[model samples]
Target chain A: MNGAEKIRVENLTKFFINGKTAVSALENVNLTVNDGEFLCVVGPSGCGKTTMLRILAGLEKPTSGRVHINAKAAGVPSTAVVFQGDSIFPWMRVVENVEYGLKLRGVPLKERRAVAMEHLKKMGLERFAYLYPYQLSGGMKQRVNVARAFACDPEILLMDEPFGALDEQNRLLLQQELLRIWEENCKTTVFITHSIDEALLLGDKILVMTAQPGKVKALLDVKIPRPRDIILIKSSPVFIELYKEIWDLLKEEVLKARNIK
Target chain B: MNTTEERLSQNRASLGKEFWLKTFSFLSPLFLLFLWEALAALKLVDVRLFSSPSRIFKTLIPLVLSGELIYHTLISTMRIALGFLAGAIPGVALGLSMGLFPSVRALLMPLVAVTFPIPKLAIMPLILIVFGLGESSKIFTIAIGVFYLVLINTMAGVLNIDPIYIDVAKSFKASRIQFYTTVAFPGALPMIFAGLKLGMGTALLLIVAAELSAAKAGVGWMIWRAYDMFDIERMFCSLIVLAFLGFVFSYLLDFLEKIVIPWKKR
Candidate 1:
């Protein structure tokens, strides 16, 4: 918790214009993420968690206010995002996908290949290095996506429910895999998810957001110890209490969103 | 163990079916040839008007032996290759520019829309006048036809690429050249191949039309000359040669597609 401030979002707001109507996706979102912290934002389906992550990733500009990354130097990218769906390039094999970031950074082929192979190995994807994305299962493809993000070695990792599309079993497996990788890399991560248990399992601190014109509803620091087993954490009393508290905050937003729909 | 055996037997059965399918496909064409021969032998069709496959082959063999067939084929092939290159290269370049830059699209899209639907053959007279009654005219006719086909398809290919891929590339901070080579070009390849396949067909069709209208030598010219002399067998030979060339060109494109876009196959 004593780590230096790695990212700051101040009075950040986003408005999407459709014809004459403007839809507020996020409103006055303000937060600070410490270096190497794994922060999860949990909210209802339309709570603009993705828009927040996109702003952090620099894919979307805030209508007002600013996001500041404490970059070590100028002209260096400080963030990478793992999108919600299958964002792995189907035309590329596993190795190529992992090497894409390094290649863009003008890394030599030999060096990039070694780095990519190392990440693929860590993801247990060494054997499928030459295989195309379409040949893999949803779980395996998500693994590739994670490997690609981590291999980039960005200053911060912005993940928008990377495992949201998978079935429950695959989602749990990837969540564990993600935790293991994050534990090793310790990158400043802002992960957005709909699952309360997932937010509790992986995040150092959890931020729950309100529905539609989303605003931060609650921010709770998860006191769960490090090197935690996700399954074991689920059965713990403290885990259940935090889950219940976050669920209670989120349930109201979910209902409000549903009523609007 | 039972499931494994079942799967093995299923594989064998499919293999057997595939073998029979291949045999039937080969036999079907041979059967048509035999039927044609039978009809011609029994004089069921007038030999003068409808030459038998055998008489066509007899005329084809002598022409091929005398190198006349090769000469015409080479001339036609050269025109097609040169014209396809001239049109396809510029077409892809312009298409990429149009797809990438809104200004280019706005400027040229109207011109493309107007001319693309006008059949290339209809403008043969204009092309002939502009390039003169020679190889230039023939090549120009084919090039113009191929250009439109390639340009339209390439533009669509670039436009149709999933914007998500572009976002990924942008996130990686890929340079413009890298964006095209690694993302846009490869991403648009399947569609581009579709365009190239279409362009190849148009090239063959336009070349034949061009040769028919104005050319000293080509399969089309030979066919035209044979018709004028009332040589049915020679005309049939030329038609058969043209058919073979079309098949070869299409097959070559398929082979190239397989090579360039290997990721398409599982």
Candidate 2:
């Protein structure tokens, strides 16, 4: 772990519905996200990947063990979340939504609007600053979500399938845009995705989790060089090997979940 | 982009229709006024019983200028405003608490369901006996009528809130107060406004009913006085004031809703 560990999860366990019909969501899951690392969590459905992300975000309490931020306590640090559903406040305009956390922290209008406009410009949404969430497309809304999270200048960003709802073309475009933003910001990020392709595209280190009682089955470090392009990365031999390994790990869980003969 | 452009054009046409609809809405009332004047001019009906618009306006101008209209309207407005606040605040608070907590809901739901059907104004005679035939009795009657409607709306609003929003707020680690103020309160605004608008109308209607029963100074009092003396022209003037007053109060509430909830804008 050395000096790289930004977040250290030590034997984190979470169980749902109490002891009555206790189903363990995460069992003694241990992981570390290094500083400036874009980590992706990929796993099958019902694998408790979201549960893990929620625990890290301090949205859910772990039944046992601990989650630490830089070896400090972990209970909702100045971390921002980009939920799958955009989570942009419907009532606020694009700029207002982007400035919400800043406003909550008592940033004045002149300063917050400037900061919000800066972020919106980066997200390519500067034109629609006055538009409401409902007025924007699925792709544009996600851009606002990204811009909002980053505008807070949070210690870490936790995104839970932010592009999962978009069409393939929008999703791909957004994935590239996210990579560009992540490269520029270089904030410690924990992105959750079900797609192996997405995990490969964004993550420096991918934590492949298993189903039922979810546990980090493997941590596959992507060997691809920086400034990676999606098209080129897909053609690379390293991408294929890592993708295959993660696919096999996921295949077992898929079969087990379906009770396949 | 193509889909949105199509939708934008469709919405533009609908907006054009909305403008025409608004124009027609204003014009329909004027058309009705013209019809009424025409009937009276042609001597189609007893002009004394149902006075013409011009006759009513002529009578209203003097009453309004002499400060009688302002005095009566002010008195009625003040009473209704006081009663509305007294009833609505507590009613919404109680309704919200009941709607949010099941234990409270279980205990009070039966009580509310039972008593809701009973006419609130029917207790006016009882209220008159208890509070006396003064401003207290009239205000109490108005408050009670408003309370029933406001309380029900408050409860329904809270009940009908999408649970997804609560879950979203919770998942964001929002504090209890933050959750209530940011999520629940705003979430319930549309419905609460619905109730408030209804309650305002109810309170205004009940004020007239209360004053008609017994009062010395109010629009309703003027109404009752005019009816008793068979002062047709003055009575028509009073009725016009009542209609205008109702319109103004409701329009004020609508204006407030627009400012507070600009999100509801299409």
Q: Highest lDDT, which number?
A: 1
* Highest-DockQ candidate: 1
lDDT of 2 by residue, B193-263 (tens): 89899999899889888897768899889988998898888888877778898899899999999898877
Candidate 1 chain B weakest ten by summed lDDT? B206-215
Pairs that collide in candidate 1 are none
DockQ (0 to 1) for model 1: 0.69
Evaluate residue A8 in candidate 2 and report its C-alpha lDDT on the 0 to 100 scale: 89
Q: Which stretches of candidate 2 lie over 4 Å from their true place?
A: A1-3, A10-13, A18-24, A71-78, A102-117, A126-135, A258-261, B1-70, B89-118, B151-181, B226-237
Over A1-261, each residue of candidate 2 has an lDDT whose tens digit, in order, gives: 234779889999998986579887899899988888889998878889888888887878889999987634333335778887857777778998788777666668999899999999988899999987878888998899889888878778999999999999999888888888788858889999999999999998999888768888899898788777877899899999999999999898877867732
lDDT of 1 by residue, B196-222 (tens): 888888888777678887578988888
Q: In model 1, where do residues sit more than 4 Å from their true spots?
A: A73-76, B1-13
Among residues 3 or more apart in sequence or in different chains, the pairs in candidate 2 whose N, CA or C atoms overlap within 3 Å are none
Top TM-score model: 1
